[model samples]
Structures are given as structure tokens and as C-alpha cells.
Target chain A: MKTVKAFAPATVANVSCGFDILGFAIEGMGDIVQLNEKESPGLEVSSISGDDGKLPLDAAKNTCAVAIQAMVEDLGINPGISIQLEKGLPLGSGMGSSAASAVAALIAANEFLSSPYEKKDLLPFAIAAEKIACGAGHADNVAPSLLGGFVLIRDYHPLDVIKLNVPQDLYCTLLHPHFELKTADSRSVLREAIPLKHATIQSGNVAGLIAGLYEEDYELISRSLRDVIAEPYRAVLIPGFYEVREAVKGAGALGMGISGSGPTLFCLSKGKEKAIQIAKAAEEVYQSIGLGVDVYFSAINTDGGYVLTE
Target chain B: MKTVKAFAPATVANVSCGFDILGFAIEGMGDIVQLNEKESPGLEVSSISGDDGKLPLDAAKNTCAVAIQAMVEDLGINPGISIQLEKGLPLGSGMGSSAASAVAALIAANEFLSSPYEKKDLLPFAIAAEKIACGAGHADNVAPSLLGGFVLIRDYHPLDVIKLNVPQDLYCTLLHPHFELKTADSRSVLREAIPLKHATIQSGNVAGLIAGLYEEDYELISRSLRDVIAEPYRAVLIPGFYEVREAVKGAGALGMGISGSGPTLFCLSKGKEKAIQIAKAAEEVYQSIGLGVDVYFSAINTDGGYVLTE
Candidate 1:
């Protein structure tokens, strides 16, 4: 194939109780990448849009280029490729911007090379790219972006990934404030150690959330949506976090928590109507505080990253 | 309704990955309690056996009597009932002896009163009794014993319990070394604080195990059966734990870990034959070290507590 284009959905990581282990892909917001064949025998970032000149243009520093580079090395193929990145999502908004770009590039490169790898096989490349953005190779965002739906990273060493069931009626509402919380800065606020009591409760909530998803128990999910480790430490960094959470809860949200590393807060609801109401309520909290917020409503994306044409 | 008898199965709490939250019921070992009505209008431990005169006879001090007393107070039905306890499981064997006794008495008393409560409704009484045995009111042991099969105690306060799925072919092998590790002492060895990295991994394993159970994915369950918080500190208390674990793993057991705060070690395998092999392997490890061990092989107990008719 001379060229391939792919789109990867945005992902919500942590999922309240699961911290670094769980996440889910969402529709309506994502990134797209196009790869065109070239004779130079290496990848290059030829063009980019939607990022407002914030993202790096150099191939080695860009998330999409890094993932494509990793994929090329792994496959032992040095075919030249020119890339174009469409950044539809905001950076550092906690909506997994880097992960979407990385995943989309990997999928596009795989398609252009005649599909040599499975979707899951591309996880390491995406995670490696994510590590360049953040210090750790966490799969919470990349796994869901690559595999679709709800995904759990069971272990980091062996890179074990499990796809969890998502309730059909579940909807996600994200409110991204016009601000940024760099992944590194967001991570710096967390404590290196935690009390055993808090750890046990967090573990229980993780188990409960997984159980709730499998059983489609909305109340259980709501009750289990607590983050003792990260949320308490990072909530102060986000504007109107507590008020937005309270407003979403009052609007019939099943649960609400900071979406990736923050500057964006997400709420889960049982239906689109409730999700819309939650979005409105959350927007009002930000508006009253004299801050601009972008609201998006979407369901769990069953498909992660895919080639637009073969 | 003059006389009622019931049996509560032994439980393996913590279940490696889910310390303080997960547990499962086992067959072949349990405690039996018989309750008979009297005219005194209060509860009493009229008789006891199999404990070698170690347990307290006072209703307030005895685990069985404490649970019965709580149930009586909650129901507001004060009737003189004498309990005859049959302690089939050894105390401090890490097989949930106290939990079994408490659950058995609660079931017998409930049955004698014409079944005033469901099995799950009696959880608090059993947990309260457990607190008297150990300093904490943890339901890991009690929930599985009362509700049957695998149970996850999502939260202790406002007590939320979720019954998890058990694979049909799964078998358990338990080896009780003739040594005691008091629950208080076993728990005392754990560090009050844990590194955040370890806590994150533990949370991941708990989520993975739950997903494994839901999908009946034995490998996932085995892969996720790791205890980074408790077992590392408590392993030294159990004699030959390391050797036994290695032997069980060599014998093709799916996973093995300390059962509760244990001198008892439990192994999971896919069939009775493999469970038997694992038990034999574990027995050799103990026997070679000149220590006697009591081994039991059983599947997950589907019936938690049951009444006996006379």
C-alpha cells in the first residue's frame, strides 16, 4: 500500500478506583494520522495541524513519530514514510492526547506495511512513546486506545493486558478547562508512599469497580468510585474540581473524577440524557468561576485504533 | 423449632492478591454448632467439643456465643438458647477457625428462630464476633463462609459484599502445618505503610483476579495471584513456606500463597488430580523438615452454611 490513514480514540485513564491499572476508550474525540510512502528510507513528520504549534515537529521528539520509529525497528523494515498528524484533542487535558497520537501512528504504519502485527502487538510501541511524554511506561491510556473499550494493565513487566466488559448504557461526560496540567507536574504532587489502610480500601474499590462493570451494577460503580491515592493529591491542581464533582453528582452522574492527570474532569452516567445534564452542571461550575470549559459527551469506544482504508 | 444444627465451611481469606477484601469457602473442613431452646431467656454456651478445652465458655467471650448474642440483640428476640460447639478446624491454623465457629452458631440460631434472616443478613454478627477474636472486623473469612463460594468484601463500613464466580474445574489444596500464628501476630508483622509502587501493582492484581474469575480464565487468576504487601513480611512466620511454594509450583499448581495469616498454605489447581499432586508435594516438603502437616483437598464450597434437620 502506498498510503494509510488511521484514527485512535481518546482514553480516560485511572477510572477513579483503578489509579494506574484501568482505563476506557471514548468516542467523539481522538487523533488521526496519515502515512505516505517515501524513498528516504526513514520516517519524517512532514506536516501537523490542530495542536497550534505546541507539539514538536522533529520526528524523534514527537509521540507519533516515536511510536512509528519503534514499530519500524521492531519489524526490521526501514521503509521511508512521511507522516501528517491531526491533533483533534487538547494536549495535557488528561484526555490521553499523546496516547491517541501514538496509537494512530502505529496503526497507520502497520497498515501501510500490509498489516504485519495485531492491534495488541502495538501496545509496547505506544507505551514507549507515552514514556517519553511522561516518565513511566504506563499502559492505562495506551491499552484502551489500542485495544478499545475498557482495558486493564495487569502488569507492566510482561505487559499483560485484559479487556474488561463495559456496560452498554454507560456514557462519559468530559469537561476540559482552558488550562494545562503537564503530565510531569501532575505526577509530582503524588506521594511516594501510602498508608496500608488507604491501600486496602483502594484495592477494594478497584475490585468493586471491575465487578460492577461485569455485572452492569451502576450503584456499585458509583459507590466504588473513590481514589485515595491520586485524586486527593491532584484535586487541588484542577480549578473548581470539588464544585464540578458535586454538581455532577447532583445531576445524576454515576461517578466523577479527574480524567487523566487533570485540567479535565470526567463524569460517568447511565444514559446520554444524564451525561448531558452532568456536562451542563459541570460547565456551570466552571463558568461561575469565570473559566472557559469544553464539554464532550460520548459512550465507550468499542474500537480503539483502526485503519481508515486498506 | 426446638433444636437446630448447622455447619459453616472453613475459609481462605485474603486470597493472596486481595488482602482484607477477598476470600473463598472450602469443603472437607468446617465447624458444626447445635442450638437448643431453654427457659432462662438468654444465650449460653452449654457445651463444647473438639477444642481441647481452650475456648471460653462465657457467651460474651466465646466467638460462637458472641455472634449468637449479636443476632439475638439485633432481632430483639431474647430466648434462652444453649449452644453446643463442634470445633472441627484447628484454632490459629490460618483456616479461619474463629470465623467458622461464629458463622455456624449464627446459622444454627437463625435456623432455630425459624429463619428470621437471610444468610448475608447475618454477616455483621459474624464479623462482630470475628473482631473479638482478632482486633479487626474484616469479612474476608466470614463473607465466604456465610455466603458460599468466592466473595469480595468491597467495603467494611456500610458493608458491601460481591459474590464472585468460581470455575467448575478448580480445586484447592490446603496444608495446615502443626503450628499456630495468631491473627494479631500475623497482622502485626505487616508494615503500616507501603510504597506507592507496590500498592499500585497490588491493586492491578486484585482487578485482574476479579476479571479472571468472571471470565473463568485460570491462567489470569494464577498470573495475578501475587501478594506484595502481606506475604513478603509474613512468609518468615510460616516454616518451610518457600520450599513448599517452590514444590507446589513444580507440581503444576496454578498458584500458592499463605492462607489468611497462616501457618496453613493453600494452592490452586485445575483438577482434583493436580490438587492431590500438589498436596503430596507440599506434604513432602513439610515431612522432609521433620514437621507434621494436615492436608485437605476440596473444591470451592458453593453452600456456605446449611441447617441440619432432626
Candidate 2:
């Protein structure tokens, strides 16, 4: 029998200007999944911890089990794996919690099988899990959690994903308030159509952001980190969103935006000291509103998921 | 009196994925404007060539004269400049004819003042001329024509133009059918609003194209050079548009799109040989329809507008 423990970093999707196509992995926070081989030819959920009984116990509904099942079918191997998910990220807080779990479980299962699949090959499994959790199989979150650094989903029909260059000095500060905003609820607020003028401006910003990342131009990044499409509608869902953003930016953040959907916000800064300052500024905003928040600050995770123990 | 002859290369705006923000300069054809410093204090349009006498003769109405007037005011000097306009590019042919004239005149005027304004500073003068020519002060064409290479107009309110790195081996093929399409007419066909899904896809492609240019990955560039915003509505304005695009792509062009608005199409290829092949393929499509076209092939113009003689 073989057992392995794996960890995958959480991801921040959209990154402001890149609505549904861009994301990046961050360190210091993630979900951990442990897998053990069994003689039975079926996947099972052995145990779940840290979720306060909020997650489903049924293997068919759990993100980790669903992802492992897909991986099993892709490998053409009998399912004899049991998954144990440890929830480190707050569920449904726009921190890519489900994606982290799926990635961690897939990495653990691959490790049990002598690592037959490369990291990129595990994307389909993570996407499957995403569909089960969020009802949409967007790769912006999963791709970064798998490949690390900034990942751009160029197209979805054939699943074209590219890993982008990450500036070494760039750091991320994530502020997760203790609240839940369902992905579907947040998405429902967006308009089905947008003005052509806004679309053009959004595209310009997206292009500028990509160019900024490659050139390491922080000023350009700051200018481009604006979400004209979704922020206007979704910002109301998060409490004190504008105040928090203004505070973080005033503390010298490059830019701040709602991560994924709502309740959680991410700020990008130049270095650790700036990231710490931004986190403090954001924390004060939530504190004044009588809401508790959890903060994570770290450099970009260059390695997405890794085996912790075997 | 200081007399100067200046040449500014034509430009291709939008560049498929970049709707209103991306453009690049091309070689082999341009407008050459000769500026003669007059002893008398006043700007005058001495003579215009190759324009079929269609352009305005009044110094206030001509694109060249309008640009030079702006330059004269910016230099805080009395207007003692007389301009001779040479129209190498077709008028209203979607080949940046008006922008080239404005850029050439500005360069000539700058040379007459011992080049007080750098190339980037001349963008405002060119934009002013564009407003008179097309009723919009867009810098997509003028920025590239002034600075050369690929230029991204990130913002317009306070005009932020960034010059991106051009792949050394990249070549452009410009096919101009002997017809005219007004920029305003082409723009009128586009809807005021677009589906959100299409906008997201368009932004993704824009980001991918910028990343591809920096990475020098031809395959990525090919995959990303798609225009979902304007091409669908405006393609009907160009006869045999689909056939020409198909033939050019089949001839191993990275991609093809309407140059600025309509009537002129640009194809990007890896090398000169491939560009020539793409040009031949595009020509055959027009020949089948009994239409004649002028083809221009050259590497991207690294030097946008320059002083030939002073």
C-alpha cells in the first residue's frame, strides 16, 4: 500500500483586467490532500478536516474525489484510492479553494502511481472538479495552481494555456474576510452584454498588463489593473470594497481587485515590506466595519503543487 | 531658409485582436512631405503631389498643414513653414494615408527647427492632424508612424503609448485593392454593445498576442491573431475578404486582418520569403474577382518617420 500527502497553492483569478483568462499562484496558503492506496477498486472519502462539516462526504460530490476519479480514468487504472482533504483556504471566498483541493489530490494520486502524469496533464482533472464545484470549468484558477506563476488561458475550445514570466520581486497580499459569497450569486450580477467602448478599454488594459509583466514595469501594471467590466456590478457584494481597495492602494499597493468573485481581495506589491503594509491597511478597513479577516502574504508560488510526504 | 524632406511609413491599426489600441509601422511605401522654411511669417501649402487634387488646399484644412501648424504653435515660433505633400499611400484606402502625411509633415517641420521635439513628442501633432482627417484623434496609426515598430496605445484620456519589442524576423505584407472605404462608414456598422463572452475572448487574444511577441513564439502569435470584435461586422465591406484571408493563411501567414478599417488587409509572416508567398496568394484571390491590387512587402519599419534631407 502507498500513501502520499500533497499540497497545492491557492490562486487569484481574473487579476482585474483579465476577466476570465488570467490568474497567478501565491504562496503561504493552500489546501492539503492525503491519499492512500486500498485493495478495493473504488474511490472513497476517508475523512475531511478543517471545513466544519461544510463539505460533502460523498465521494461523487467532493471536489478531491471527483478530480481523482477523472485522473484514474485518464490513467486507465482501477480506482483504489481514498482521499483525505484538509481545508486550509476558506471555502467559497474567491481564493480558489476548490481548485487547490483538486490539484492537491491529483498530485497525491499521481505521486502514488510513480508520477505518470506531468503537471500540465492534470489540468483536465482540475477543470472537471471545478465544474462540479462552481458549475463552470474555467481554467484561470486551476491552470495557475497547476503550473505556478501567471497563467493565461488563451482559448477554451481546445484548452490553450500558457505559463507567463513572473517577476521575481513581485509579491501578493490576499485579504479574505470571514464571509461567503457564492460564485453563482456573484456571477449573476454581471450584465450579459457590455458597451463596446468598455470592451476596447478592457482589452487595452489586458494587453498592457501582459506587456507589463514581461517587461517588469510596475507602473504599467498599476495602470492596467482595473476591472471595468465586472467590478462595477460585483463590488457591491463585498462589504466596504472601495474603502479596502483605496486603503491598500494608499499603502503603496500596485493595484487591488476582487479575487475570483467576492468576499476576498488580492493586492499586488513590489516587495515583502510593501505587501505587509498593504495587508495592514486592508485589515484596518475590515476591522473598522466590525468584520474579521484573514491575511496571507507571500511571493508568487513558482511550484504549484508538490508532494509533502510519501 | 532650411528646407527638409521627410518620409513617414504607413501603419496598420487594430492588428486583428487589438481593436483600437494596437498598431505597427510598415516599410516600402510612405508619404514624403517637403518643408521649406519661409522668410515670411505664415504657414502655406505650396503644392501637393500624387493626391489627384482631392486634398484641401487651405492650410487650415489639409492634414499636413494642420499638423505643421500644431508643431509651430508647440515650438512657440511664428509660422513660417510652407508644406509640399506627397501622397504615396492611397486616400481612404484603410492604409493610414492621412496619418502618414501628418507624421511626415511633423518630422519635416521638426527638422526645420533643428529637431526640438523628439519622435514621441511629435505624436500630439500627428493626432491633431488625424482629428481633421478622420474626425477622431486616435493614435493607433500615428504612434507607430512616429515611433516605428509595434505600438500600444494603453490609454487615451492622457495618451499613454508604449512601444513593444518587435520580433526581428517578423515581416508584414500589405495588400491594397484599388478601391476606397471610408473609416467612418466601416465604424458605423459595429454595434454599440457586444456579448460579454466575446469581449472576454477578445481580451484573451490580446493578452496572448502581446505575450507571443515578447516570447517570439510564432505558433502562439498565430493562435492569438484573431479579431472577434470588428472583423465580423466590417468584413462584408471588403470584397473577397474571406477568400483572401484563407489564401494568405494557407500560404503560411501567421494571420491576416483588415488593416485599419477596410479596403486594405495586412498579413504577418515569419520571414521575407513567406511574406512574398502570402502576397502572391492574396493577389490571386483579387485576380479571380477581376480586381487589381498593390502589394507591399518588407520587414517592420524600425524607423517610423525620418529626415531624408535637410
Candidate 3:
């Protein structure tokens, strides 16, 4: 194959109850990357768009380039490639922007090289790229963005992941309040230690959330959608978070919480109508606080990342 | 009905990864309670057996009596009842002895009153009784003992529970080391706070364990069966625990850990044959330490508590 173009969906991690373990891909919001073969013996970022000139042009420093470099090294095939990055998602909006870019580039590169790796096999490279972008190797965001549906990171050391079931009727509503909250800053607000009591309750909720997904019990999911670990600490960073949460709850959202690390708040609902209603309610809260919000309604993306053309 | 008898099986709480949230019922060990109607309107403990006089006979102090009393109050039926307690499980062996007794009494009382409550509706009464026995109203032990199979206590305040699936081929081997570790003392050894790093890993494992049960993935279950919260602190209380764990692991056991709170160590295996082998191996470790041990082999009990006769 001379060239490959791919789109990778945005993902919401933490999922309220499952901090650093659970996440799901969403449709409609994502990043696109294109890889073209070059006669020169080096990879290059030929052009970039839609990132407001914020992302680095240096290939080594870019997430997409970093992921592609790892893939090239692992495959032991140094194919010269020129890349184009089209950023469809906002940076630091907690919608996994860097992950989408990294996953898209790795997938595109894998396709251009005649597919030496499986979809899941590219996870390590994507995670490595994520570390370069965010200074941590968390799979919660990248796994779902790469593998789609709902992904649970069972263990990090051995890179264990399980694809969990998402109810067909479930829909997601995300409101990105036109602002940025760096992943590092959001993480810094959290406590290094937590009470054993809170830890136990959080653990119970994680188990409950998984059970709820398996059983397809919406009520169980709603009841278990609570973050005893991070939400309490990070809530201060997101403006009007509590007001938006209450508004979405009143509009019949199954659950509502920070989407990834914040600036974006997400609500899960049983149907598209309720999801849209939740988004509207949340948008009103953001507007009341004089914050411009971009709202998106989507269903769970079953396909994590895919090539536009083979 | 003039007389009613019931048996509630022993339970293994914590389940290695789910401290204070997950538990499963085990066959072959439990407590049996008999409820006999009296002409007068009062509750009383008529007799006791199999406990060697270590249990309290006072209705308010005894687990069985306390459970029956709560059931009576909840049902608003003041019928006189005399109870006979038959304790088949050892006390403070981490086999959920008090939970079995409490569940048995509530089930017996419910049966004597002609099934005034559904099987799960009696959970609160049993948990209330557990509070009297263990100084806290935790349902991990009681839920599995009462509802059968595996149960996850999702929330404690409103008492939410989700019954999880267990693979049919899975078997359990339990070794009671002829020693007592009081629940209070077992709890005291734990720190009031835990590092966030450990807590996050523990949470991931809880989600992994639940996913393992749902997918019927034995390897996932084994890999996820780690207790970062409780086992490390409580391992010292159980004599020869480390040696027996190694022994069981060498005998093809998937994973091994404290059953509930020390003295009793349990191993999980894929079949009854392996379970028995693991038990024998664990027994040798105890014997080498000059300690007597009683071993039991069981599958996950599907029936938590059952009436002797319908």
C-alpha cells in the first residue's frame, strides 16, 4: 500500500467509578491522520492542520510521530513516510485528543506497511506516545480510542485489557466548555493518599459499574456512577461542574461526571433523546457562567479506529 | 408452620481483590438453625449445639437470635419463637461463621412465618445482625451466604447488591488452621489510610476480577486475584500462610489468599481434582509447622441459604 488514511475516535476515561481502569469510545468526535510513502529514508511531518498551531512540528515531539516511530522500531521496517495531521478534537478538553492522534497515526502507519500488527498489538506504541504527550502511561483513554467500545485496563505492568459490553441503547453527551485543563494539573489536584473507607467504597463502585455493564442494567450503572477518589478533588478545577451535573441529572441522565480530566463534562443516558436533553441542560449551566460550550451527542463507538481506505 | 429449619453456607469475603465488596458462598460448611413456635408472644434461644459453649445464648447477643429478632420487627409479627442453633462452622476462622448463623436464623424465621419476605428482602435483617456480631454492617459475607453464589455489595448505605456469575468449572479449597483470629483484631491491623497508588491498583483489580467472572476467563481471574488492600497487612496473622500459598500455587491452584480474615487460607482451582490436590498440599505446609489443619473442598454454592423443607 502506498498510503493509508485513518480516523480514531475520542474516548472518555475514568467513567466516574473506575478511575484509571475503565473508558469507552464515542462516535462523531475524532482525529484523522494520513500516511504517504516517501522515497527518502526518514519519516517526516509534512503538514499539520486544525490544531491552531499549538502542536509541535518536530516529528519526535509530536504524538503521532512518536507512535509511528515506536511502531517502525518494533516492526523493524523503516519505511519512509510523510504524515498529515488533521485535528478534529480540541486539545486538553479531556476528550483524549493526544490519544486519538497517536492511535490514528499508528493505525495509519500499520496499514501503509501492509499490516504487520493486529489492532490490539499496536497498544504499547500508542501508550508510549501518550506518555510523551501527557507524562504518564495510562491506558484508560488510549485503549478505548484504539480498540473501541468499552475497555478495561486490568493490569498495567503486563498490559492486560478486557473489552467490556456496552448497552446498545446507551448514549453519551459531552459538553466541552471552551477552556483547557492540563492533564498534569488535573492530576496534581488529587491527594497522594486516601482514607481506607473511601478506597473500599470506590472499589465497590468499580465492581458495581462492571457488573452493571455486563447485566445491561441502566439503574445499576446510574447508582454506581460515582467517583470517590478523583471527582471530589478535581471538581474545583472545572467551573460550574456541580451546577452542570445537577442540571444533567434533572434531565434524566443515567449518570454525569468529568470527561477524562475536565473542561469537558459527560452524561450517560439510556436513549438519544435523553442524551440530547442532558447536553442542552448542561449547556445552559455553562452559558449561565458565561462560558462558551461545544456540545456533542454520540453513541458508544464499537470500532476503535479504522482506515478510510485500504 | 410449627417448626422450620434452614442452613446458610459459609462465605469467603474480600475474594482477594474485592475487599469489603465481593464474596462467594461455599458448600460443605455452614450453620443450621431450627425455629420452633411457642404459645407465648416472645423470642427466645431455647438451646444451642456444636459451638462448645463459646457462643452466647442471649437472644440480643447471639447472631441467630439477633437476626430473627430483626426479621420479626421488620415483618411486625410478634409470634413467639424458640431457636436452636447448630454451629457447623468454626468461629473466627475467616469462614464467615457469624454470617452463616445470622443468615440461617433469618431464613428459618422467614420460613416459620410462612415466607413473609422474599429471599433478598431479608438481607437488611441479616446485615443488622452482622453489625451486632462484627461491629459493622458489612454485607459481603451475609449477601453471598443469603443470596447464594457470588454477590457484590455495591453500596452500603442503601444496601445495593449485584449477584455476579461464576465459572462452573471453578472449585475452592479452604484450609482452617485450627486457630482463631478475631474479626476486631483482624481489622485493627489495617491502616486507616492507604497510598493512592495502591488504591488505584486495587480498584483496577476489582474491575478486572468482575470482568473475569463475566467472561469466564480463568487466566484473567487468576491474574486479577491480588489483594493490595488487606492481605498484605493481615498475612502475618495467619501462621504458615506464605508457605501454604506457595504450596497451593505449585499444586496448580490458580490463586490463593486469606478466606475472609486470617487463620483460614483458601485456594482457587479449575476443577475438583486440582482443588483437592491444592488442599492436600496446603495441609502439608501446616503439618510441617506443627499445626493441625482441617481442609474442605467445595464449588461455589449457588444456594446461599435454604429451608430444610419447602
Docking class of 1: high
**Candidate 3's residue-wise lDDT over A1-310, tens digit each?**
3888999999999889888888999997899999988998778998889999999989989999999999999878777899999999998989999999999998898888878998999999999999999888889899999999999998888999999989999999998988878888899999999999999989988888899899999999999999999999999999898998899999999888888888788889999999989988988888899999999999999899899875
Tens-digit per-residue lDDT, A148-247, candidate 2: 9999999988999998888888999999998888888999999999999999999999999999999999898889999999998999999989999899
Model 1, runs deviating above 4 Å: none
DockQ for candidate 2: 0.92
lDDT of 2 by residue, B180-241 (tens): 78888999999999999999999999999999999999899999999999999999989899
For model 3, how does the per-residue alpha-carbon lDDT over B1-310 read when each residue is reduced to its tens digit? Answer: 4999999999998889888888999997899999988889978998889888988989889988888888888777788999999999988888999999999999888878878889999999999998999888889899999998889998977889889989998899989988878888888999999999899899988898898889899898899899998999899888888888899999999899888876788888998999989988988888899999999999999889999885
Candidate 1, residue B72: lDDT: 86
Cα error of candidate 3 at position B245, Å: 1.0
Candidate 1: tens digits of C-alpha lDDT, residues B1-310: 3888999999999899899899999996899999988888898898889999999998889999899989989988789999999999998888888999999999998888888998889999999999998777889999999989999999977999999888898899999998878877888899999999999999999999999988899999999999999999999988998999999999989899899999899999988999999999999999999899999999999889888676
* Per-model TM-score (chain A alone): 0.98, 0.98, 0.98
Candidate 1, residue B245: Cα displacement in angstroms equals 0.5
The global C-alpha lDDT for each of the candidates, from Candidate 1 onward, is 0.91, 0.91, 0.90
